[model samples]
Target chain A: MPMSPEAQALLKAARKHPDRPSDEARTRMRRNVMRAVSAGAGAVGATTAGTAAAQTLFAKIAGGALVVAALGGVVVGGRALFSSSESSVDPKNAPASTSTSTTVVGTSRETSEALGSTSTAANLDPTSDRVVASSALRTTATPSASSVASSPRIATAPSKPAEANITSDAASAPAVESVDVLKEEAALLASAQSALGKGQAARALELTNEHETRFPKGALSFERRAVHAMALCALGRGTEGRREAQAIVDRAPGTPLAERVSAACP
Target chain B: MPTPNALRSVNAPSAAGGVIPVAATRGSRSTTPPKTFDDLYDDHVDLVWRALRRFGVSEPGLEDAVQEVFIVAFKKLDTFEGKSALSTWLYGIAAYVARNVRRSQRRRPETPTEDAGLHLTSASDSPEDEVGAAEALRVLHALLDELDDDKREVFVLAELEGLTAPEISTSLGVNVNTIYARLRAARAAFEQAVVRRRAKDARQLQKGGLPCR
Candidate 1:
């Protein structure tokens, strides 16, 4: 099954020379992601806002850090979780800041602009252990529904805009409702998978039940069933898990899901 | 226990190579908390971009696809309970977006353009090197296109992106044994594809078709 030398060479060369965006595109997309977050395009609530604010700041700091490192010839350290910035300028020891609430000094307007905004750096949140992006310093401070509609980039909105809880006419439309159902199904399945991965089989089963209640004939029924079977195996219900896995394998042979199911109980 | 070699090879050919220090950006998830959205984007944008391209998101639609992945990421960030590496989690999201983009593009096919392959060349690359790399990329994509979705994904994630079997399993929600099995099958299929393409090209040359170069 090993690739021939020529095929291997091609892959090695391609890997060595993978495509990437120009720095400009990277910055523009970063700004767009931030804009999307600020506009509350995905979901709405206190939790969403807090996470978005923190993310916005992280993007800013990351952008600034890259520019500084490039100019200073500082080989920024790997993804280490360092709390203090004692080695900020020293490339030899500097790790890219993943700290939620480190105070960044000498953040310039150029860096801000390069990151796709013209806003000044905001105060680091001292109260929270995580870095909280200041909402007041957001480039688009007043992110209204009207503004979200006006911007072409933001127009696409989150693929799951229904999660945003917007009760407008658009949200009530039948077509939009269908898409939201799928998105919610996916979200529930993802949470279930996360739970399974975390060894919370009972919790995973509960989420699956919630999914069944919300979406009995959901688009992701197959995926949900697979997760359910796996959870059953995890909880030591080998006979039931095997039966479920076998049903899926018989239905769809040679698929990843089939492979997963076969192995889940074996 | 194949570890996803988080970092790119140090001996990469050129500065224009634009190699991503994936490990440098994709922080170890061993003890680190779930990454902030900014951290996730900054750390793995290149990885996501490359994945989308390999996943068949055309260059024109590539940016939108990338945006969609992160927006989905933003919405689902809380669900990321640090079960898998950040890169793998993003890959899962990118895979979903890429599939959707490909599906939509299929419904509205665009006119094929001459500049179809990934634009990996940099200002630093010599014209000869640029041509070579571009052609190699073109051939690579052509071979990949022959693969079915499942095999293609396995090949792209394992061979092209350098994710380990376990990481791909976590991202894909497949069994690790299945991943290894698929990787083996994919490599063999890809080699056959290369051989078939070369044989066909040779036949064309013998029939006095244009030179490959």
Candidate 2:
């Protein structure tokens, strides 16, 4: 639709003109760029560039000429190993897209899955996987009695305050007996939080589910539930999100966890 | 593979200054001096700065963002074919960098924007006009903020910056037709925003100062 003449003029009047950087700002930026360049960080786009630049600085400071002849025999011996690895890299120069592609969507499932596969062996059973967030009845010994006390029904409060109490209550709660498991689960839950922070809702969902499977009675239940609800909302499944939010509200209405879920899933 | 005529075309005077001396001096030397990152920076710094702002980078982050864009450009300059204008290439880099910064900021939500001076004016305007113009700019930015990132980028390029559809397509990495559709939605949204602002302003004028204050 064509904007009305008056509306067009209204917006046109406010159109920002090109910005001019102050001389100080320009000088500062130039100084920064020059510093980065002189440090040889600009040689090969990011990733390995930092390592290569460090190597260059090391070569300079160590007086390589003095040691080159002495080290020649060892260098020649290792040449085959270094040469094989170096051959895989393109010599034409670093590609611009190198740094661009490294950003993960939400959770890097590979890391989470790797952590899950290797470390999860010591984890509790995946019986919690059968526990749909909707069930609200499976109080099956999730170490957090504080959480079960709040609601035997909702999958909220998988993250915070009660997290420490989860360890204190661990002596009585036989389902989750070790503080080490709680710490490991907290770290895994943090990865899901990171993924959610990156707007990776699906990845967050996976990691949240993984946390539940590994530590169904995990301490960070509040944290994981909040993240799970937010992830659902972010993925546009608002009804599911609202249900989780309702549970958080019903279970722990005053805590930050409930507040976050209420705000997001609302 | 620029002909003398084509070289002459790009060498035409620019709004910022005179022609960028990249390919124009062709016949002189095979060493027509490969374009340095600084040359790209000098020629298109203003373009990068403005585009980044439109992409929702805060004023405080703009300086670091510009340097980051160029550092990437510096490393990747070897692969830049002249198929698109240098501004287009730089805009693409600036857009990606700005979007990433905004996404990262959203993830943390703790690093707050400290640049409240975005609407403060130098005495270039008379006292009366300064308030109105600054308020208008603030309102426009607020409305721009309400737009989705993609719509905001398209709107800023096409409407405010006067970039053509094809140019925006290249800059934003969208299909040309997609650019038009987005532009249409953007214009509609912008127009509605302006109308909404007018209603608010009309109601508030009776109460005195701009609502932006």
Candidate 3:
């Protein structure tokens, strides 16, 4: 069944007018890919020097807010006490960033400031359904005075068994669903971090275990694993903690997160 | 077109450890050892971008879709065993990403249909040629939308992208015979569609509408 000449001509014309990504988009996406690649590409052990260069690049590109996001996860998790709702946080009522773009790198200081108060406020109402807004995730990522002010909720949340809260809704698109997933991921990791802070290493490990089950490839997985490693260290499981932390350090050397992970169980 | 290393089987990276070193190539031969990840991005970004469009990824989500593909590629860079052309491996990734994007789009309350093919960039210098090319592309997309996902993919890869049957096989992970079967069915469906469209245009021309190209 050969295509007629007319069909062939149509394909040729369509090919001539094929869609292309604009220069700005191409460059932005390239930078993003490079950043992510640099963080983990070196783990292959194929290029030691390349890995060294990647480490430097990772340090350069991983803005201050990224480190905060990691540290903030700990701060926010410490305060979040899980209550009733098993549903994933709704992206519809999520911060304005969720509707427009899936990822709003929350680099601005104002955004970071807002996150601290927002997470604290959300934690204040354990009775209300805990909504994981994009800002709340940012709060977990970027530590603020307000986030730190909120005392640990490890006493309240661990009394009940941890529930799966990241079940994504079919009504939401991936962009919105990602926001929801990130929120749930942040909440889980935040609670785990909080547990570690309150000397409840077992509770922290439990939350991280729940996180692993819900979001195996979650955006904040690195932080979750880091907290998991820390929890292991706190529980006197030094060998396991050291091994876990070493892999993360190997995968992304020089980054602040890896540096912190390396300190685990030492 | 089958890339020079079309038949190469990419060995999935070992559990222990081994790097998937990239190789750079010119027209039909290897020119240099595989360059940096940046080189891979430079060489194949357009292929991934257009392939995503052809695969029905909506324009609004296209950027994220492309990023997702590269991110996966970057994470799985060690999996590149050179078993297939780098482009083929990337295409396979694009196909998967596009499907997910579409699936998500469908779940939305209002699926956006603003993807007018007329906005596609035209290579023609003259206004008349540009209009003709745009109309042709519009017609092409209309026909393509009628086919099922499987046949549509085979048609796009075979007719528009010009990947040989074997190359499409490797990209799609479908058997060669199956690729041939879908391509044949898609061509026949496309030809019948073109004939119907031409007839409709002729009727419209008689009714005092613009001339059919």
lDDT of 3 by residue, A43-150 (tens): 112112222322222222223212323323322321221111112212221111111111223222222232233234233223222322211221110121122222
Judge candidate 2 at residue B167 and give its lDDT. Answer: 88
Residue-level lDDT of model 1, residues A91-204, one tens digit each, is 211122222222222322122121111001111112222211212111221232122221111222111222222222222333223323433454566567667767899998
Candidate 1: give the clashing pairs.
Answer: A100-A131
| Rank list by DockQ | 3, 2, 1
CAPRI-style quality class for the chain A–B interface of candidate 2: incorrect
Instruction: Give candidate 1's whole-model lDDT.
Output: 0.50
Top-lDDT structure, candidate number: 3
Best by TM-score: 3
lDDT of 2 by residue, B1-213 (tens): 454333423333221221122332212123243343345565666667777777777665566566656555544443455555666666777767777567655654354432233332221122236565554455456667767877888888888777789988976678999999999998888777666655655555576644243
lDDT of 3 by residue, B126-184 (tens): 22377777666666676676677788789888888888999889877789999999999
Candidate 2: chain B TM-score against the reference chain B: 0.70
Error of 1 at B17 (Å): 35
Worst 10 residues of 3 chain A by lDDT: A152-161
Candidates sorted by TM-score, best first: 3, 1, 2
lDDT score, residue A157, model 2?
Answer: 23
CAPRI band for model 1: incorrect
